[model samples]
Target: MTCALIYRGNDILLCRDENDKLSFPVVDINNYDNSEIIYFETDGTQYAVLPEKTAETIAGGVWRGLRESWGELEPKTWNIAAKGAELAHFMQTNRFCGTCGTALVKASDISRRCPACKREFFPSLSPAIIVLVTRGEEALLVHAKSFRRPFYALVAGFVETGETIEECVAREIYEETSLRVTDIRYFGSQSWPFPSQLMLGFTARYASGRLRWADGELSDGGFFTRESHPLLPSLPSISRRLIDAWLNGEIGGK
Candidate 1:
């Protein structure tokens, strides 16, 4: 997050630890010249991470000072712990190859080389498209079938093969709700690393169609006016930023 440690300009590029609890595990780097890095064992139970959070935590400082303030620990921002965990997971899984059952190992540097098939593997990322469909002052929001009781967010979906991001946006909206969309506008992007997903956010104008819900995915769908809506669920996602921007206008609420 400090803008130096991360590479590739790939959304996050890099990680740092920001643990506050004394009960959290400590990383003993005495062997590595007593480096300040802290280590912790992760069982994939917490933080959606690997067997531990140590290597990632020590490097968490990479995100410090890059954020305008620490209070804004939003998903759009990447931290060192997350980056390290992602890398570890990426490497761990690349240990096996789908084409062949042979074992795999890291190449000279960043590339992963399979010993059996001579295939090279690199880190992977899932692309998600988040779009805001609006009509006049009203915008469309859908409640996920899983979180229908507690949360409701805007229309969003993952990218499918052979379609551009904008094309995917239109198709997803049509599939989820039998509606048409136009004036697709690029808003921003966010890193939704629940397990590593790169989300691309956009804003669109409603072209036509009545209220409809996608089968089995969304439980509810409707248009909402921020000023006159019912008591909606609390905002808990970087994906919600688009709706927020549209709701409060470009300036948004502080």
Candidate 2:
């Protein structure tokens, strides 16, 4: 499975790393020769420092000379260099060891190395569980307390230490909904680069217990049928796919 880097959404946003200071790591899909920086009356060459806005503009599906229809953008779908500015910030901030406060060096295997302590620090990504809980044909979703009213989403939480992925899923379900899951079927995963997270999406059958909201995470919880589906969060998201599988049958695309 290839993951996309640039988020054009049909509008493109170009990126540049002048002096390696900017964060957006956009590959020149056009593959223009960018050997040296030179200016001219007209663009001397097609090659140029990809401005951040170019990526965003193409992402929005608007072009200065040409145009495209309203369609989903087909991004490169792979970014070995990474995406989102915050990830760059994370790398920069965490370069120093918090324990000893020493400058770090980039390691060979995508991590920062400490010469003194011989410690290798990698880019940290949070593991979050998002489940599509079902009871019979109806699926469960929750309205998180902090969110605007009526915005329903799946039961999701960050995984903690000393917990298996399954354990985290079970714990999150019970803790948030006061409901237990009898079976959890692995559905799929997605890379959410808003910060950094590997989302593990699952489908769980509701075993027992009634609706109960724990703490401030979920303000409301309930079941919804396929026809009257709640205004759930966006699809193209792991959480949405899991529910979509349950509603439309896991095997067939709907």
RMSD of each: 8.7, 9.4
- Candidate 2: worst 10 consecutive residues by lDDT? 64-73
How would you encode candidate 2's per-residue C-alpha lDDT over 79-188 as one tens digit per residue? 22223332343454576876577887766424577878878886688899898888877888788877654668789889999999999999999898888997787788
Q: What is the C-alpha lDDT profile of model 1 across 1-254, one tens digit per residue? A: 11222222222222323554111123333333212222223343222222323334444333222222223444323344455445655655676776897787667333478888888887688888988888888878788777635556777888987889999999889888888999998888765544567889888888998877755677787887778654444544455577667678662222
TM-score of 1: 0.70
Q: How many residue pairs clash in each candidate?
A: 16, 21
How many clashing pairs does model 1 include? 16
lDDT of 1: 0.59
Q: Ten-residue segment with the worst summed lDDT in candidate 1?
A: 1-10
